[model samples]
Target: MQQTVPPPLRPYIIHPYLRRTHTMIKKRIEDDILIVTLENGRDNSITAEFYHELKDIIQEANSKPSPKGIIFTGEGRFFSSGFNLSMFLSFKTPREIADFFSKTEEPVLLDLFMCSKPVIAALNGHTVAGGLILAMACDYRLATPNPKAKYGMSEIKIGLPLAIAQGEIVRFGVADDRNYRDLVYFGKMMDVNEARENRMVDEVVEESELIPRAKQLVSLWIDNPGRAFTPIKRLLRGPLADRIQKGIDELDWEDSLKCFFYDDVRKTLEFVQASLNK
Candidate 1:
């Protein structure tokens, strides 16, 4: 079957955002929202370059004539698979791994949290581990009703502890505490319907309606673009964000770095590489 054309592109003609040519992010301004797409292909793993692109987008979003709101989504089958394992595995020492995690946790993340404009997520498909982190940074999340589409924070399975600070960023959007625990503790990927039942997904619709519905939802928030939304966002999230900051400041990322060198991690990488080849 022929693939559908990508959502229409808009020129950045005079935008202030500085972007690297190798970044996988795509940006377009649609109506009152700045639409940013994660285009890292089927897996859409987050690379250092992805962070650079995201930082540029947020900086531009904060510049003069900044967009009133933002819409973030993914292209193709999956939203994001989280950090690229190839890059993570490149480090030979615990120090290198610590550096990797530090670089991955960029200020752009904080920028997303503090942006005055409301950000919405059009969660197109499977979102796992750090993928959930990206989705959580947005103010709203819309997901497609695919039985195979799963969402979760699966960092623990890889011998790395959950980035609880980032995890809290996503959990706040959820309506129930039980649902939040299920996602963080068990680390199992949950289907679209399950995500909706737990309030992880704001709306669940047919795959065909995903983009249009996302646009519709963002449009609804445009009416009071500068007045109501931003303030409430600050008031509601400010405290939780402070805790996240504290958690990051105290985390022993060094331990995680050491864990990455174990034989199990190496074996896991080999299995993953072999499967990808297939």
Candidate 2:
């Protein structure tokens, strides 16, 4: 298949809101596929800056002579440790925390889920909580078969309930009702094989073969033109998308914020922070 080479992308502007120290995302175009790597030091913990950069990059990839697909992966042993816990813990008000999620995280997940081209999350390592939500937003997910690498949502254990959008993404992505309940209710981290068995990940491959397998999957869907592909995806995913959007609209942000104020959550956050510091 002859692939279309997209025109040069407009240089992305570094948003003034982004912290100057956090240039952790890197992008490279490979024959119609955009490979985006997240290497924010050790854990690639997401922050406001990470969200802005990621949103811009994905937007860029969707522009002129749009790439056939996008592959998102992380460097080192952790794909993402989820949200930047330290920063999140610092917010003083419910509104501030609500704004952070509504303004930063929500849009990015929506973009990935509703993207015109196929999006694949190539998990090189551990993926938890918000990281799992991000992976769920993708059309397909692939993970490296490392026994040490874990994947699952741990928000319940941390005294945080799933946001409406987050919950919808998981429900829509993972088809089995039993698997969905187990993941969210228990907040258990599963190994690669277990994740695959529960349909959380499409396939598990060796670290060396992760990107290649992702590219192979992208090739299968790249043939559809954007006009056709976009609408078809909308139609196919419409019911779930509508359900998710409605839930987002009805979510009680103020009440959701109260979770962070609980003693159990604070203790859990403290524990998580201490462990990360080690």
- Which residue pairs clash within candidate 1? none
Q: Could you give candidate 2's per-residue lDDT for residues 138-227 as a string of tens digits?
A: 888999879989999998878887777788888877858888998999999999989888878988788889999899888777666544
Give each model a TM-score: 0.83, 0.88
Where does model 2 exceed 4 Å of error? Answer: 1-21, 225-227
TM-score of 2: 0.88
Give per-residue CA lDDT, model 1, range 142-236, as digits (tens). 99877888888776666665554566777777777787787777878888877877777888877787777777766676565344655566677
Point to the candidate with the largest TM-score: 2
- Pick the lDDT winner: 2
lDDT of each: 0.69, 0.78
Predicted candidate 1, C-alpha RMSD: 8.3
